[model samples]
Target: MAQAADAEGTVVVTTTAEGGRAGARALATAVRDQLPADRPGVVAVGAESGGGAVIVIAVNTAARTAGQDASTLVKHLLHGRGGGSPELAQGGGLPTGQLADTLAAVPGMFTAG
Candidate 1:
C-alpha cells in the first residue's frame, strides 16, 4: 500500500492486488487512523484481472463532513468505469496504473481551495 498527501490536504491511500476481495472498510479504517483529523480522503484498493484492473474505493470522514456525497464523488471519478455506494465503490477496465492516479486525485475535488 502507498499513501500521499496533496497540497489541498486530501490524503490518498492505494494498494495493488492480483485477485482477491480487498476489504474496503478495513482499509478505510487503517487509512483513517493515519490521516490528519481535518483531512478528506479516499482509499483505493485495486486488483488485476483479465485485460484490465478493478479499483475499489472508500471515502473518509472529511468528505462526509464537507457535504461531499461519497457515492456521487466516486461515480464522477470512475467516469462510468464502475459503481457502488458511498461507503464502498468499485470500478474496472482501467489501465494498470490508472486507478492509483484516480484515487490520488479524488481528494482535490472535495478539498480544493
Candidate 2:
C-alpha cells in the first residue's frame, strides 16, 4: 500500500495513462488553472505499467469536503490500461499518509507531459 495525504483538507485526483508516459504534472497544471485562484494544489507522477501513467492530484480543502477518499480517488483515475493489463495500482495511503509517494509509483504521472 502507498501513502498520499493532504493538508487537513485537500482535493485529490488521479489519472492513468493509456500509453507512453506519466502525464500528472501536465494534468496538474491544467487542473490548477481551472481551480479557484485562492486554492493550492499538488500533482504527483505515480507509476507506469503496461504503457500508461498514473497521475495523482490533490486539491486544497474542497476535494475532501466532497467525500473523496485518496486511495479510491486515485484508483478511479487508473481505471483503464487495456483489458486486464493489470498493474493493480493505488493512489492514497493509510488514511493520513503521504499522497505524493503513492502517486510517484504510478508510471509517468509526474512527467512534464
Q: Which candidate leads the pack in TM-score?
A: 1
**Alpha-carbon local distance difference test for all models:** 0.63, 0.39
TM-score computed on alpha carbons, candidate 1: 0.65
TM-score of each: 0.65, 0.32
* Candidate 2, residue 75: lDDT: 57
lDDT of 1 by residue, 1-113 (tens): 66565635556666665443455445555665666767776666666666766666766767567654546655677775567776567776777667567666654664647
Runs off by more than 4 Å, candidate 1? 21-29, 97-113
RMSD of 2: 13.7
**Worst 10-residue lDDT window, candidate 2:** 80-89
